[model samples]
Target: MTPLIEADGLGRSYQQAGEAVVALSPASLRIWPSQRIALVGRSGSGKSTLLHLLAGLDQPSCGKLAWPTLGPVESLLPEKVALVFQAPSLLDSLSVAENVALPLLMAGQGRDSAARVAFALKTFGLLALVDKLPQTLSGGQMQCVAMARAIVGQPKLILADEPTGQLDQLSAQALLDALFRHLADSECALLIATHDPVIAARMDIHWHMEHGLLSCGERTAGSV
Candidate 1:
């Protein structure tokens, strides 16, 4: 089967203070459907940079990337690939329901957007807070809403960057539980960047990043 994402010697660098800073070293990997992956790394280890490159949010300075199973880079957003950041990044002006519904609306799912939004909110147990603004929700609740928004469109891949970074241990676990429940039997692959060992252990495959270099372990079941 074709991979959802494939990278060949992918890397990125930035010019800072008249010097080149390597954010990520060339790394190659394949992300197949329904694969659960843990991108384990410490802060500034280039985990986020790799994610940004995969999500097409930033252009790579070197190497190649392709979505063989999905499509061209232009067609990966709010559908084939969804990215959830450490920050909830919710629009304060929009209510919980509205925030979750934004992706569908952007994808032109006009007629069924409301129903899909409702289901997504319900999946994360945020239905009661549908009308609540971002400011009114707690940190955990905000992150749940963010994840709900991500899955509303049922993207093939979800790239999460330290999703539980801001929550307490219990809250973080709860947030992950909700996410796992929603993705339990779906074909939506997940690539979560985290420093937490507990979080990393839950994934099927492990990828490590250190000092801008990336390494991978053997793949487990449910992967291509």
Candidate 2:
């Protein structure tokens, strides 16, 4: 099968204090449809940098990245990819439902797409909070809202960074259940960057990032 995403020697760097700082070392990887990948790393380990590059939110400082499924595109399409950042990133002015619906609306889905929006909210157990604003929700509730928004558009690939960082263990488990359930239904690929060992262990494939380097390895029993 053609890979949904491909990266060849992809890397990123930034100038800080008049010296080049490598955010990600040259790394290559492929993601196919319905693949669940976990990018594990500690803070400042370049996990977010790699995810941003793969999502097409940032350009690689060197090398190449491509979405073969999208066809001849220099960058990814919004409708083809959904990214959930570490922060909730919800718009303060929009209600919870509105925020979740924003991506669909932006993708040119008409107002009749309310059913899709409702389903997403229901999936995340946020149906009652639909009318609430971001400020009214707790941090964990806000995270659920963010996840609902990411999957609402039904993007082919989801890149989530520390999605469960704010939630209690039970809420985190519920969120993961919803995510995998949706993935099983849609066959959309998921790449999540998290520091939690348990979260990484649950993914089908695990990739580790450290000091700007990336490595993919087969799952080992009780590996941390």
For all predicted structures, in order, the TM-scores are 0.94, 0.96
Candidate 2 displacement at residue 79 in angstroms:
1.1
Q: Model 1 over residues 1-224: C-alpha lDDT tens digits? A: 88899999999999999998999998999999889999987788898899999998899999999989888888888788999987668999999999998888888886788888988888777899999999999987888888899999999999998888777888778778888998999989999998887777788898989999999886554322
- TM-score, cand. 1 vs. native: 0.94
What is the C-alpha lDDT profile of model 2 across 113-164, one tens digit per residue? 6899899999988899989999989999998998998888888899999999
Q: Each candidate: RMSD to true structure?
A: 3.0, 1.4
Off by over 4 Å in 2: 72-77
Error in Å for residue 112 of model 2: 1.8
Model 2: worst 10 consecutive residues (lDDT sum): 70-79
Clashing pairs in 2: none
In order, candidate lDDTs are 0.88, 0.87
